[model samples]
Target chain A: MKSGTWRISGRETSSLPLFNTEVMGVAARRTRGRRFWSNLVNGPAARYLFILPTILFILIFLGYPLVQSIYISFTDASLLRPDVNHVGLKNYAQLLSDRLFWLSLRHSFQLTFTAVALQAILGLGLAVLLNQKVPGIQIFRNIALVTWVIPIAATVVLFSFAATPEYGLFNVLLKQIGLGDLQRYWFGNRDTAMWMIILMHVWRNAPFYALALLAAMQAIPQTLYEAAQVDGANAWTRFWVITFPYIRYTLGVMIVLHVIFTFNNFEFVFLSTGGGPVRATEVLPTYIFEQSWQYYRLGYAAAIGVAMMLILLTITLISVRLMERARRS
Target chain B: MTMRKIGYYSAVYILLILSFAFLLVPIIWVFLASLTEPRQITSGSLWPGLRSLTLDSYRRTLGSADVRIHLRNSFVIASMTTIATLLIATLAAYSTSRFARISGASITVVVLSQMFPYVLLMIPFYQLALQFNALDSYASIVFTHVVVALPFSFWMLKSYFDNVPRDLDEAALIDGCNYISLLYRVILPCAAPGLVVVAFFAFVSSWGEYMFASILSQSKQTATITVLLQGYISGRRIEWGLVSASTILSIAPTVILFALTQRWLVAGLMSGAVKE
Candidate 1:
């Protein structure tokens, strides 16, 4: 009976080997074709192919434009004149002596710093408030986020209405609160024009900072706070020691991003004031736009654009390095 | 101590509510202005009374043929831009996430693209459009919108893809699936939430975009709602009611979209911040 079983097992084993060899033969034949196709589709070439579309689009839209902008900054080109001539450093030289350019730069700095500073402070406070485990906090948070979600154009229009000299919301609210003496054309007054623009900017953007900082605040471990409390650390001390360290990275990134955005913010200033009231609110972007489109001074605008790019690039590099250093420690 | 804690909580809640009110008052004011009569809007009333409010502004703004054309143009351009951005960003993100050879270069390119002042590109883009006779066409507007939306979408999706487990890819491959099928069947399903967030972002960015849309499209035939809104503001006779109504209309879609996708949008933005 054992020999009969062995004979049966031997036949099974021999047939299995024969079957395996047949399968291997087929697989070997198929692998050659599969290998070629896979190499073509899934190899190094494939990576380039996958990224080719994005790269091509960027090159055409972003890279080409950037190069052309730089080139135009060195030439005398205007929309009105068809003929273009290369003029080395003339636009840059003119910009150095241009009072409007200096004034615009100063206004851009003033607006960006003030708005970003206010946003960071208010946003941090709001974030901490929302971080509490109170009921209906989500609703409050959503209401705050509404400003961020609203279109900038809509915000501009609404605020423009609010800032009108007579019968506007700002003046109305002030009068209701017994400050009617301060009622005036918010955007028409040169002194208040930049401030109104800055206020609008802060209103539109502070919610973004609040949301971002709230996320960072939520990520802080509960254990740290508990341990700090046990160690007799007061609220202020605990915040300085624990919360500040945790959110510093996010804060740094937010500040840099906000600065870049506010520096180049054309739409807000353009739509609201049009850098008006004698260019009181004119920043680098609006100035560039006015030069290019309104005045048809393409070369001069391109030079300003180049200058803006350099400033932005330097700030970005410095901020990135600072962030990397912070991450390391 | 319990009394003190309750007092503290109350103070915090009060402050939070006040901050929320400050943020919401502008939006509420705008809504009220939109509903009020044109003359009543300038009456300096804190809140317009029921007698002062009317739906006529909505009727008039929505009824206008010019407004309708502008709205349609905005929607078509934004939707086309969103679709094109998603398609290109998805493929590029997949490649960057899956392959090591091109990932670093691609990421660097995306980051660098973000730093370029978009104002600098406007002139060259306009010139190029003029050269190609692409002005007043959806093609030019949509193309620029896609360019603006692609870099961030690529980064967001790439980060999401990074979080997806690689085991699924290998398992699918062992099951005899090719790369393309693997993406559609495995990676895409896993990354569906990320894709939705990217799509929402693309749609909103294009929908609210003002710069290129205003520059590239000149005539009312091709102008976006934003351009039209600007026109209303800059016109000789400013109709406050109609302007307010159009403002609300232009913002309504985004507001509704935000309310619906608030959770995902918040999550996506938080992840982006943390990752950065």
Candidate 2:
């Protein structure tokens, strides 16, 4: 039935008359006042009409704000006073000299690399595991995605509960496993704070990569693996030679995406540690937040924001090129 | 060889189980904590016996006027943002998918827009809001949330639209249907699953959003559930019971929606990744 309808529709396009004004009565055409108006409304101009709303919206909300943010970075602006004056490179210079700014930058890089690396590796492992013809694997995959589905705020709350020092679930588990000494204040301790946030991030995001890679892995022909096995390739060799190559493009895309997301992630760090324990977890986003809202240094924060944008812009361009290459190949 | 195969299978099963446990334990722990007494949660027992479990925390949290307000605000903002985003994104996706000239520029804009960090936009948005006297208003937050959800939604929906057969458009055109009516009558209905995916993306993005919600909606009147949840964490005297219950409540909608739509969601994500 579906195929019959599809065939009919296929023929209709090839056989249908162009601009069949006969379908509309002469009276209706007279009421509508000339074919020019109808043609204009229904022609190429109509395509622009469809997209104009979105373009206008982006211009107002995204494009304008971006330009404004860059402009604000160069001026001496603060929440305290409505007036603004051009300050040249003062904000950028201040950001360069600011110890906290440098620290936050370092933290952003550390968090992005560590979290993305962990997520990629673990996600690939999970994808490989789930790709096996194991019974009930789909259930496990769905369960793994629960963290990704839940709100970051909720995840932060749960992790904070687990990380509580004295009686947290993490400590209790460690003690139960006779690794009691390994347990410490996860969020409160400076040494472990950033790592805990990274752990939380990986836990929430790895499933995304896992699911995406799993889909890609499923698309790979089974004959490739069979051929590798016939060639006497071991399990490790089979993975490295066949599986890894098949998913590398996807892996690259996910890595770039993860970098962008982790670098800009605000709520996970904000809600969990609030970039606390003496700024040990202060990433760029939270730093910008504090500088702008807490200290009312709007211009300085905008400068930092601009720096973050420029870095991400470069990564985005590279990602676009990679995606294009992947698409072609 | 059979023995080695058995060993390999067992190891894989064990690792899979362990990973599942790692992901599930925190959620299960939070669920248990939400049901336990406040003192018991602080005491941090691995489990609260069935007898110790009570609904008082959920009751108290839900009974609070502040939580109610925040919940309402979150619903309003997220729903509005989803509607606005879908409206704009659907049109844009349709235009790009059908038109040659617009496709290249539109796709690039959509992809590039994702890299603009929301933090940068927040500074200027705040200033704009202040100038327009739009702070603490639904319009301010909803507008920003729409922008936040737009880029990805547009891309995903465009991919969905691409899957739709263009032959149907020609068929409708022959029936005297114009572009607008054709999109309304033919393309959108056929792309229902894609629309669902886009709507879910927009809804969830705005639902869980915190940064813009916190910054824009400062007053309690406009605060979202996420903002209220942050208050629970940042407060000097933490109420673990209330926090757990509220956290569960805050996420329940999204979790339920996700569970119901996991298949479509995963498929959408896969196509978006591979196709792009």
Clashes of each: 0, 0
Per-residue accuracy of model 1 over A54-169 as CA lDDT, tens digit each = 88999999888888888999999998999999999999999999999999999999998999999899988888888888778888776567787777888888888888766778
- Model 2 has a clash total of 0
What is the Å distance of residue A289 in model 1 from its true position? 1.1
Report the C-alpha lDDT of model 2 over B1-276, residue by residue, as the tens digit: 599889878988999988888888888888888899787777656777778889999999999999999999998998999899999999888888876356677766765677676777777788789999999999999999998888888888889888889778777876777767888899999888888888888888898998888889979889999999998988887888999999999989898888877878888866765565
Mind giving the per-residue lDDT tens digits that candidate 2 earns over A1-329? Answer: 23213222224233433444554436337745667666555655777787888889899988887788788899998989989999999999998899999999999999998999999999998898888876787887776677887778888988888987767899988988889898887999999999899999999989888998998898899999898888999989998888888888888888887888899988888888889999999999999889888888888888998899888888778777877787577
lDDT of each residue in B1-276, candidate 1, tens digit only: 599889988998899868877787777788899999888988888888999889999999989999999999989998999899989998888887876446677766776777677877787778788999999999999999999999989888888887888878766755655557677899899988888888888888898889998989979877999999888887766788999999999989888888887767877865754566
DockQ of the candidate models in sequence: 0.51, 0.57
